[model samples]
Target: MNKSPGFILTQLGLDKDKVEKLVKALDPKTLQIAITDDFGSSFVLSTLSANIASIVETNVVLQHEKDGDLGNGWLETNYAGSRAFVLRSWKPNESDVLEANLTFWRGAPSIKRVVIRHVPEPATQRLLLEKGDVDMARNLSADQIAGLAGNKDTVVESSPKAEVYYDGLNQKHERLRNPKVRQALRWLVDYQGTTESFLEGRFKVHQAFWPSGFAGSSTETPFRLDVAKAKALLAEASYPNGFEVSLDASNFYPSIDVAQSVQATMAQSGIEVNIVPGEQKQVITKYRVRNHPMVFLYRSADYLDPHSNADTFTRNPDNSDKAKSRPLAWRNGREIPQFTEKTDAAARERDPAKRLQMYLELQKIVQENSPFVIVFQVQDQPARRANVKGFVTGPFADQIFYLLVQKRGSRDRGLAQPGSPILAGPDPGIRAVACDAPRASDPRHPRAHFLRAARGRLRDRPGGTDRPRPRDRG
Candidate 1:
């Protein structure tokens, strides 16, 4: 809705010239559509109309039919109470036919038809939409969102992902391990200006350590940006000069705001900084070593966890007990956190305030020693099809399954049974099951910002991130 109709025709994927040529074949007004996400395809899709056509959720093509251009799509199956859905794309095999996928929130996905696609990039996603393979995609960057300004027929919603973007501290370094240094870094960041300029007012600058709805996250006081205070902290740390560090980058992900701001602010104290942008995997490998030191990163929350977050970076990696069946982030081959070994006794305290206090104390200790610097806790955001309504945003800032989004022709596509499904975009009786899908591996994964000397442990996990990991604040 933020975009207009005339803009739809200019999109390259629509084959604008051909669409105009076939203007007589379709109703100009009925082809309208709307949706949101910060993915790359959104840039081009934003140019489409929303009057008659629209996309509800994100789609990724797994296997394709060479002859028909129809391929099998995927969704979260481990999620219980989720509806069955599929996007027609590549038909790699006959088995793909009659394949169905469930969208519940938790459990292992027992997919019958849909394939799970972990590394979804914009280029391939854009190609799928332009070819009429899917009606919609999710998430686009500020630049990508602006590019869709010309597309009139499609509705584009550039919702920021429910996560915080901040510079994490490296706990391993004795000097930076100091809270003064971490506090100074926080003061140096121009949170509001940078987020607004980069995310176009879609992102939230969290004032609290934990985002809303998490166990330990609280809405207490806020952290303001203050360069003057930052200078004082540097002086207190005896670092008239800033520390020297190599901001290993994945060429695609590492945000310019993070690198440039960090570089400039530290320079004020005489600390020199270097930047090394390369393939994500190699850079991540180089970064985790005790010898390879990185100071901070721009990050947002990946999941809702107050206690287990440090398990990845601080927990002794060799420890056998695991929250996730596989080796987690920050833990790959290294040692696990000391806290993970000790169970939280607060849960048995039975006193609400006492438990809250205990968790707060634990969080404080983690903050004191951990290399991760949490900026703000964010909220979850999930989008759906306009026609396939009955969707609602939640207090929690992450994706949830189980709610039904009824598409206009989904019955034909074998989604709903028809005869008036949920079409209103509000939380409708949908139950949320927490899906603990393992974080799929990507070679370009930005884990290097946290765990080094542990990359080899990840070899058992096979995967790589999309081209640049546009959101790799780490």
Candidate 2:
């Protein structure tokens, strides 16, 4: 699980009565108030410090909602907001609908709206980007990005991601319990060769779990494939003839290929590896439960900080209350008090220099003793149409900064026509051309119902029934 510090929720013009009504209907534990203002104007919602680590886990925020069931009735799909965009209703396993707010809290979003289609296959995603059906192709392979080089309308953006792909061992297994045996297996992996061949020179051989430029990263190249060294270590650990172990991986492209490559390499050292492939969700479940003896997976840090990586990978709840679990690299329930102490101190440290030292020390310690075979750091390639401005790929695969994106000619062409592009040219006295007026029931104005409902709730003043006129948002 990756953890971060940036997600926020605020009241968006909902009346006191509606807020209270929604709060009463929802579970108390969904969001606890750490502190309410003395003026009764605002409150800080807390994630109950204990389970803070789990916040980074996938879908933790949306896990409570059931099929076609949003938790609160009064809390309808549309909540009035001044954010760049408000989320409209969505179909499960389909698409996310967002509509722009001209009077956004920060400023009006450049583009009127965005609809993200769910495209799982890379081939189809690439085709969409090439054919101009989609504006961007995320997580595209190097080859795919290269294929779009000749397309004048498209451009590929490449960045070094704070991620690593590795094979983790469940230390609870008797054969892998010994540090020597685990170290031996690490040597059996051809990390450098895989980066050069499979990754096509795009990725770098990362020795430690942390990304190269981070505070807790190392410049050491300790483990390399040496058949003699692997054999010696295996024999020393009482497995001279090698032992067979099942290597499980998600049926994804590079992951399966990596597992197969490792199988061939480890075979030379007498470590018979049976490659087992399954769906990503099922494979992760097996890894999380410590059922898989070995797992080949790709995991990225949730945040830019070293604490995010260290807290999730090194510290366990038993030793450090801050962490709940470290399922990716199972440690056989081994509690290292010293490791926990250092990690906790680093997390609380305010001095940047001292904090850096603490994190670097932890990385070195974990690298020497942990049950992980660190492979390589990820290099991401995301392609977008040249007209799709203000979008960049962050370390996280799913990070979307759509509000910042604007089509190059959006200003002159005004609002875009859904089924077509906004056209612009070198014509004299060019002026913004507004599209056909939208209908009241258009999805873009999802909160139209809420606005109407609020209007109907007129209250009786001393003289007469008083109602509020809609504010001129423009």
Candidate 3:
């Protein structure tokens, strides 16, 4: 039950030397310090604070309070972009936070500059790639990626069960409170159709609160499309007019295809769903704050631990901004506890069969009373570039938090093999290498030298002389 805090990080390619060097450079007492500027400090510390906020609710005392700040939050950001973000730190006294944010504009070459354009639709993204407009655009249906894969320029990488896509059953609704309604909705999803039509045969419907590999995950496919059974369940529950509910996620991951599909598919089960499509912010407001929507779609985590993301339904049931559930109106009288106590028992509970038993029970309870319906686990994108070298993938590839090494092409600096010494920084002579290639000293970091070359840390693409496509990326 002893797990390393950075197991995921190392597994994602920040292994050993690179991780050690980066941590040494980033840590205060360590020799190599990346930046000391206010903006950089803000960016780094703020991210840390946000992470802290997510994991453990603790006091985050930061250093400065920059009032009226504005900046752009993008895939690869810089000092200029910091101008676009308005930051509110967890604490107004931590200097490290400032250093991390402004790491972009320190006049040093960065590790990489990833371009993220909100394609929002798979077909358009495919079209853009076919036209050479994007280096990478996400949320494509599995089929779209398959079609794109036929082309040399585009590639698709996804997770088997990276995240769960599910329908939510509001705890407040009277009939929904009954386990029958929630369990019935599970039987209504066309998992095969989704795999064929949306995912393009790239995904499978997953049951259990967690996916197959996690500590408490199960490989059982409990729910399948059975409209007849669903109908019978509804009839037993009484009134087949089907409950009126609003489907919150009306937009698509890559396109409106997924949302529209959900809308049409759910209607097949006789549920009267009012399709509502709007800005995600507005929809989130309605779901979390206003409590106006009965069903909100959620795709949550299944990594590090199964209990990691399960608390959202168990705790954040109330839309109240103060982060507390309202008093219960049930026969039990008292309000249900927002958060079940998480302990060593919960995190490292050893018995797989026994733990899975507990997890199954939780799944049943959640389905019966929560506002989440677990759907098929999804695939995610990884760090892929044209001719880029020295990059590795990790379990967290589905989660972007690790280092990706990039080197200019062979002529850029006569690149060495992985684990080889960095002899002279990036220039036209550097050779680019990929993670899939033989061992080469990773150029995107502070490598020990023959002359010890310094890459942009993430700056230049692999072969710089012939720039790939300088097209205005979205």
Error of 2 at 206 (Å): 2.1
Question: Sort by TM-score, best first: what order?
Answer: 2, 3, 1
Top candidate, metric lDDT: 2
Q: Which RMSD values do the candidates have, in order?
A: 21.3, 12.8, 13.4
- Higher-TM-score candidate among 1 and 2? 2
- Where is model 3 more than 4 Å wrong at Cα? 1-143, 152-155, 160-162, 201-204, 241-243, 252-259, 315-361, 367-371, 382-474
Per-residue alpha-carbon lDDT of candidate 3 for residues 243-307, written as tens digits (9 for 90 to 100): 76776663534224555665666677778777677666676556554354444444445244554
lDDT string, candidate 2, 79-143, tens digits: 32234555554433355555565544467677755666656566777787776666776656656
Clashes of each: 84, 1, 82
Q: Arrange candidates by lDDT, highest first: which order? A: 2, 3, 1
Candidate 1 CA-lDDT value: 0.39
Error of 3 at 284 (Å): 1.2
Query: TM-score of every model?
Result: 0.50, 0.68, 0.56
